[model samples]
Target: MQTSSNTRCCIVGGGPAGMMLGLLLARAGVAVTVLEKHGDFLRDFRGDTVHPSTLDILSELGLKKRFDALPQHRVTGIEGLFADGIHALGDFRGLKPFPYMALVPQWDLLTLLADEAERYPNFTLRMRCEATELIRREDTGRVAGVITHTPEGPLHIGADLVIGCDGRHSRLRNAAGLRPRDLGSPMDVLWFRLPRHATDPDGTYGVPGRGTLLVLLNRTDYWQIACVIPKGGAAQLRERPIAEFQARIARRVDFLGDRVNSIASWDDIKLLEVRVDRLPQWHCPGLLLIGDAAHAMSPIGGVGINLAIQDAVAAANLLAPVLLAPGLPDEATLAAVQQRRLLPTKIIQAIQIFLQRRIIARVLAAHDDGKLVALPGAARFLLRFRLIRSIPARVFGVGFRREHIDSP
Candidate 1:
């Protein structure tokens, strides 16, 4: 049997964007429902770096204390190994108050947001409910709701608005006929975990090795590591013996020592196909898209989650009032949200594209030729002055535009 329900706003995908938007809208007394295909947010290798801008928003929403209470690792600066030696790439010490990026697991952060949103009677979070298609108003052909497959049966939700927060592979984007332009990435990442001890490095950092770059996130007891390789390289890599991979990693990050062997088989590592793309148009008459649904970012600086949260904040600021008073937001009203967020998205993607093509591509090419790669000139210049490191820090740690919590 099919069931039906209605909400003021229905957000598909209980990701960072969906949860934050649902929470913010609910706080403003709008009835919002968030649908999640998964029963829980426990996926590994998801973006976990909560940047300073997001921290400031948490403080505004009075959730800063709760965030700080979560078990997390703090990254004060970005360091990288170069031809000369280890150099400081960016420093976050000057950002004051929340001077560091919090490396809390993404699942924990989502749970915190969900718990807070549940306090409002108007907010509903439906887990294991996969949005399958859009429900349209026959007269105007405007999106009015979504058809979802729940554990119980097929369910229909009628709403004044529908939001797509379903990440890069968004079904809603496809259903709405909205397409993203693909800006290519040079690499994919192989993710795995290794043990960390009291004597290990205190902060997260990266190593630009012979051909590939390695990023290590200090996750308290274990190191969540990303090994970047050329695009479409995972199959060839797995064909080789696992020990060969282990030896390459241990050689790059020597401190890992024998712990690299813990990656016993191919099953221990996960391949993330890196993609960069963005939608030229982010909305239609009754629907809007945000976060990875609108733009799939390269995991260069780990700014994906932070950028999505910023989108949520901006959406709430502009959307709450209209949702509360009006019949429904028109195309122009929805376009306004895209206009506000477009510049920042463009700026970040531009930087990521540049780095991928200029820096990352060069490094991998040099490695393929068995040649040594030197640090880029920009990095060398930034290393010359202590205060200058904060520029990139601000760019990555905060972002192009910082969104504040303006919605009640």
Candidate 2:
């Protein structure tokens, strides 16, 4: 399946990473093609956190005014319900220009990026096209292009580089024979939305008590709920009737009243298999992997999307100039992309892993006999000082390594 079609870059996934990289390269006057498996970006239960770091990138590009106009909910901080009372663990008020996280649907963000990228003549996005396999030049053994299944039929896209932004369960990553170094995650999240009225809570809420932990994120019209459960406890939970869940919700959030019944059937719930992992090496010769394709983060702080986006920004800054040159990027250049982003990826993943084992897992593992315990040393320290709480805000809001918009 070879079509004489060629571009400067072929991005396998039109997700945050792919679409973003596509827009950056095209904006820099390099031809770029992005392939998305889905016909549209209207998918449910996707990551919706648009952190300050991501917003900073848009602001640097002079798109802040336009982006702020989009429909979004502002999250100023994250609160957890402890024995004493609700304590603030994340605060974004101290951050600069954009001091809060924007709770916008992932699809809307993708659509916005596509709209902005289309303005560039060199940007091409092929919806409903799926990458099936990678094509390696037999003589050099370096990836030259990708074979995709298009509406017409099989189509071959030849490019100087192929980036796998495909995702955690990436077919491209699998095809490339890359193995993920699992950092381990002890819990998974069940996602479902409950209608929000004018009287609902103001911001995010964490109800932790009696062997249950639930996180509710305000989404303006509705609340995106994350019911955290043991790694493989969903099956056991299903043994009980839906009424049990309704009862549990009522006990946890007294304010919700009877609204918990809105989740009448199990079909309304979607389970997100949380994964904490990263590939040891992100690239091989002419190929590169960014976003979830390179590292999969837990939904603890809703920082996965931001991490992936930063990877795209860094990748574009590094590879765009070289793409405009005669020959494709060599192995050294691809390694440099991974080298610059690897430390940041490890730093964030390490924090997530620590929280999962040190806090979340302990919360789930505890047998609640209705006895309230004092906060752990670390959590108590976080609550005792306002500045200490700000640490998490800075970590989740702006991220570890701040990548500038150098490609622009």
Best by TM-score: 1
* Model 1 misplacement above 4 A: 368-381
Could you estimate the TM-score for every candidate? 0.96, 0.95
Lowest summed-lDDT stretch of 10 residues in model 2? 368-377
The 10 consecutive residues of candidate 1 with the worst lDDT sum are: 365-374
Query: What is the clash count for each candidate, in the order shown?
Result: 0, 0
Q: Mind giving the per-residue lDDT tens digits that candidate 1 earns over 119-186?
A: 99999999999999999999999999999999999999999999999999999999999989999998
- 87-129: candidate 2 lDDT, tens digit per residue: 7877888899788999998988898899999999999999989
Clashing pairs in 2: none
* Candidate of highest lDDT: 1
